[model samples]
Every structure is written in C-alpha cells, then in structure tokens.
Target chain A: MSDTILFDYWRSSASYRVRIVLNLKRIAYRAVPTDLLTRQQKAPDYVARNPQGLVPMLHIDGQDLTQSLAIIDYLDATRPEPRLIPADPVARAATLARAMVIIADIHPVNNLRMLHYLKNEMGQDQAAVDAWYRHWIAEGFAALELMAPENGLFGCDAPDLTDVCLVPQVANARRFELDMAPYPRLTRIDAALQAIPAFAAAHPERVKPA
Target chain B: MSDTILFDYWRSSASYRVRIVLNLKRIAYRAVPTDLLTRQQKAPDYVARNPQGLVPMLHIDGQDLTQSLAIIDYLDATRPEPRLIPADPVARAATLARAMVIIADIHPVNNLRMLHYLKNEMGQDQAAVDAWYRHWIAEGFAALELMAPENGLFGCDAPDLTDVCLVPQVANARRFELDMAPYPRLTRIDAALQAIPAFAAAHPERVKPA
Candidate 1:
C-alpha cells in the first residue's frame, strides 16, 4: 500500500482541491473518508492526527500535513512536475493571490463549520444559511471574474494553483445555485479544468461512497 | 518616494502580517492607508488596481499584488534575507500549515465584513458577534498551541511566515478579550514575537492614522 494517506470528506471543497493536486501529480494514496456530516473528522483518532480536526489532512512523507494549500505547496515542492505554482516570483505571487481569493476569502466563510455555527449557534434558518453561502461566493467570484484571463486556463496552458482552487469553488458555487451569468470567464475556465483528467478524477461524485 | 506602495488598513490582521514582513526585509515602501471602517477598500480606483478590493495590496516591482500571504511570498522571493518561508519542503509545509490555522480558518471567519454580515444581515447582536469571533480564535489557537515549539521563535532564530501570521492574530485575540491562559505555548511565542522591532512597529496602534 502507498504510504500517503489522505483523510478527507467527500463533499469538502478543501479536500476536493487536494484531490485535484494529488491526481495532477499522480500521487497514490489510501483514501480514508472522514465524513463531515457525521462529525467523523472530529473523532479522537482523527483529531490526534490532525489537531485542527479538519478534513484533507494528508499523512505523507512521514509528516501529518493539514491545510489544503500547504499540502499542495508541499506536493509541488517535492514533485516539481506540471508545476501547480509558477517559478517566477511575480507569476507565483499573482497565481497565489488568485487562489487566496477563494482559499482565504470565500471558502472559509462558507465552510460547513461556519455555516453550522450560523444555524446552530446564531439561530439562522436554512434560507439565511443558504443566502450566507451564496453571498460570499458571489463576492469572491465577482473579483475572480475580473481577474480571469481572456483566454486559456488560469495558469495559461496546463492548470496551475489558481485552477486547482477555482474548480472546487466553482463546484460549490453551482451547489449553492449562485448566478453564473456574472462570471462567464470563471465558468469558461472551470469548464476547461473539468475536462482535464486530473480534475475530472477528483470530482467528489466520482469518489463518493455508494 | 519608493515605487513600492502598500495599500492597507490599520488594524487589519491580514495587513498587519504584511507590515511585519516588509519591516523584517527592511524594504522601503510608501504606506497608503485604505481605511476599512468607511469601506474605502471598495472604492472604484482601488478596485481597478485590486479587483479583489482587499487591503494589504502591494504595488511592487511594477505589479499589483493582493492577499497578505501572497504579498509576503513575493517579498520573500525578492528579498531572500530573513526568509519567512523555509526552503526545505517539509519545513515549509509545516510552517505554512501553522500559519493557515489562523489565516484560512480563523481570520476569515472573524474578519470585519463577516462580523458585519452576522450583525446586520443575520440580525445577530453584538454579544453573538463577539462570541462568534472568540469561538474561532480559541479553536484555532488550541490547535496552534499544540503545534508551537517549547522554546525560541517559530523559526528558531528569527520570525518566519508562521510567526508573521501569529503576531497579528494574537493582537486580534486580545482585541476581542480572548482568555490566553489556555494557549500557553502560543502565548509565550506571541510574547517573544512582540519584542521584535519588526513586529512592534507593525502594531495597529503604532501604525494607526492620526
């Protein structure tokens, strides 16, 4: 069995991002589905491995790595093929900035835990939670739409970190029924990325347990 | 006047992270205060430069950069001295993972805009908003405290990305009156980090506009 083990939830956008990177790099790993809906991720055994008790914790290279972007950074650094992040400093910064719009700005606000807090702790209804999710997605996508290139993938040619992050977020956007008309560029990019075998294989539907 | 211009808001944890990096690198740049309180970040002129409409946008090397981590990555790549992110792959991943606990998980949820949404849109009261803020900080710090070193700076000798990210977050925690007693390791590290000139000069109170 491959030493790399990814503890991830099927529907998590963060986990989806890591799965895309792992597929792109052709990294083999055992998948341990830690169902977020069931709070399996917060189990003592899992929390011992990941103090954050968050999914997408990758046990690889003898280190337990948490955080999707950090894991991708490690993969890119170690594998160094089909480079997800650019080598040029300017290009790297620009690419990462785009990724952070989703990673830091949008996804966190819309994360399941945050949504749960809104509902359980703050007494928000389903409609309120759904609106909350859509609000952040639309806000981040508006900026991303402006930032998207007029042509080619986000990385230009093969997909890069920006594309890796963009695809999962787009999936979440669609799940939330966000209006895609305002983000034609991002929609085009997501379509192109989805066609890539690496991204296609990482789709949560493909990995979901029957 | 330096060609590099940093458009940032005082008291912004994300912006404070960038300020620490710039000071550590001894990079001279003009500070253009973009007030968040008045929603100055959404101004069209600023949005034209940074489509994300976020502060901590660094106009450096003739390129406009947004996102605090991405801006720091750019600075680290160019400056190279007092390197914030480690060169070793495993070390880099570990450092980044620590930083992301606060950056992606905590700060994003407790950000000004998110708090505004809870209070204004979700109709949560000030007490609810404060609880929301503290809950995330305590959760993130709990994880980080476990990951913190028993002694020395986060980088052993000098501050790295994790340390850079931590100082600003600790400041925010104090602002929200989070009881730091539980996170002794993180609290110790924050104390050491605060003594550093770079971190001290970047404090929100120090940099606040008259």
Candidate 2:
C-alpha cells in the first residue's frame, strides 16, 4: 500500500479531529507537524502543496486534500468499515449539520489566526481574546447540546462525524477555560468518547511535540 | 412530492449558497425570509425549529436541515441531475476544500452576528468592522484564486459547490466595497457564474423582502 502523509499541527482542533479518524480507521501514516504558531504552514513550499496554507492537509492515494471536514469526508468515502459519516441521506445530513456547527460556525472564529488578528490587529487584550473564544463556544455548544442525542454518542452506538468534530472542540473549550456546566450532554458525550481508545490516542496533549 | 421550505435571509451568504443549488436543480420551494437584521432568526420559535438559530434552515424529505453545506449535500444526494458536489472522492474533496475556504473560514468570521459583536460588544466602529470583513475576504480569496481553474467555471462547464459558495461571497465583497483588482481569476469566475440564470436568480437583491 502507498504511504499516507498527514501534515498537521498537534494543537489544531481540525488536525486533532483528523487524527481521531486516522486512528479509528487504523490507517498508519507519518505525521509531519506543521507548526502553526511559527507560521510554518505559510512557507512557500507548503503553500505550493496546499494553497490555503492550512494544516491537517493529507496526502494519500497521490492526492493532496485540504479542509478537515472535506478530508474526513474523503476518508469516510474510501474507508467504509467504521463509517464516520452516515450513508443514509437523512442520517448523513443530520450528522453533517451537527458536525458543521463546530467546523463552520465555532472553530473558524476561535482558530489561532482569528485570535491573532483580534489581539494584534484589533489590539484586544488576552482577557478579551479569551472572552471572544468562549463566546463562540458557548453559542455553538448551546445548540449542539440541544441537537445531541440523549442515548449514546453522536453517531448513537458508534462515533460518527459529529463525534470526531466534537472531541477536538471540547478540548479547545477546556484549553480556553470555558465553563462546561451548561453542556452536560456534550460534556458527557466527550467523556464517553474519551474512554474509547481511538479518541483518547488522538488527544492534542498526547500528540504535542516536545 | 412534498413541499420544500427554506428559512433564509436574503442577505446571508450561507443562505445564498443554498438558494443557488435549489435553483440549479430546479427544485420548487418556498423561501421564508428569516431576517437577520431584526434578530428574527433568534426568536424563540425559529430557535425551536433550528436549534442553531441560524438562517438557511431547510425543510425537505420530512427533515429539518441546518448548515448550508450540509443542506446542499442533502440536495445533491437526492437530486443528482446537476451534481453540485462531485461523486468521485478526489474531485469531491477538492471541490469541498475550495468551497470551505469561503464557507468555513471567511463567511463565519464576517457573518452578521460577528459584525454585531464587533460593533456593539467590542466597541468597534464601522471602519474597523469593515476592515475586519475585508481582511478575512482578502485572505480567503487569495487562496481560492490560486485554486480556481484558468478556463471554465468552478466545475468547468457547469457551476459546482465552489461556484455556489463563491458567488455569494463575491456579492458580500462588492457590498463591502472591497477592491477586487488583485483576484482576477476569482473576478472572472464570479462574473461567469453570475451570467448563469440559477446564479443570477439567487442574488440577495432579487430575493430581498420588500
């Protein structure tokens, strides 16, 4: 089999989400850390490969893919054993919608570049920056909490796309010290997913470079 | 066929993307204008239906779908005549990645609520808010311009998901008075897309409630 290469940052929520899927599928690949703090993703060579210059770019099957959810979709499409996205149309739409609550609405606003812009360009202090971060999480999670099922994980017996997206964002929420009291369902789901070996192995702290 | 209803705001870029696909597929539907400016989306009743309280909540196939891309995915899956998202895995990933540069990165950061927070909560004047809007657009567009093909539309002969996403964001850029001189490729693509009847009919101006 050809080698799979994942260019990712350990601390990136998007990257973390991809890692969980890779681990869940047991797809062995080399992890090339693209440090976002130092802006290594913007290097000319990296830009040549990924025009967006974003991390979590995967090179597999001789194709270079960008965007976390897109990459996940590609992964799910090719590796169908433990499906991350549902195959049924309605089920798939529900899963994608819940997943996008984080991918589109919450994560983008709180990602490193956005935070950097708020602090450097807008002259916001750390407190304000943290507030901005928590604000988005609060808004997104409130809806997600409502959408979350009362029974099992996001995929209801197994982890699906929403579960993959949720773990990383929940990790970020804790990193920013956002309160978890209101999102009991999410907090509980995160806890259950964490106990699963695949999700646990992909934690940012576990993968962080020395 | 059952009735198709879309709860969307005329000016919302996310809502606009969904509109393009619905028109392209020739799906007849009722568009209920959920005004963002008056905080109509945040009303208790709307929130009950769409827990996210976001525009472009679609009702079809006896299901309520949120998130523009997810809704679009559902549409493409059910209505396969003019595929907005590619069926081939590699092509789908590339299309989705390009589309997400706008969907996930640019639009979310510059959405109505984000702008409202900048002005009201963060005390940013209109000028600062406008600069913030232009900054994200410029960053996202620079990457998208690189990914855009030199020849045909985003899908070559027909408009795809990337084209669906690009037209609305380009509309937003023009609304904000952004200088489009740098992104010649994107400008060319947007112009070509707008010439299509499906793209033209989805314009905010055409759909805006009187």
**Candidate 1, residue B108: CA error in Å?**
1.0
Candidate 2, clashing residue pairs? none
Local accuracy of candidate 1 as per-residue lDDT tens digits, A65-102? 99999999999999989799998999999999999999
- In the range A125-163, model 2's lDDT, one tens digit per residue, is 999889999999999999999999997999999999999
Q: At residue B133, give the lDDT of candidate 1.
A: 94
Q: How close is candidate 1 to the true structure, as a TM-score?
A: 0.98
lDDT of 1: 0.92
Query: Which CAPRI quality tier does the interface of model 2 achieve?
Result: high
Assess the local accuracy of residue A164 in candidate 2 as a C-alpha lDDT between 0 and 100. 93
Error of 2 at B149 (Å): 0.4
Which residue pairs of candidate 1 clash? none
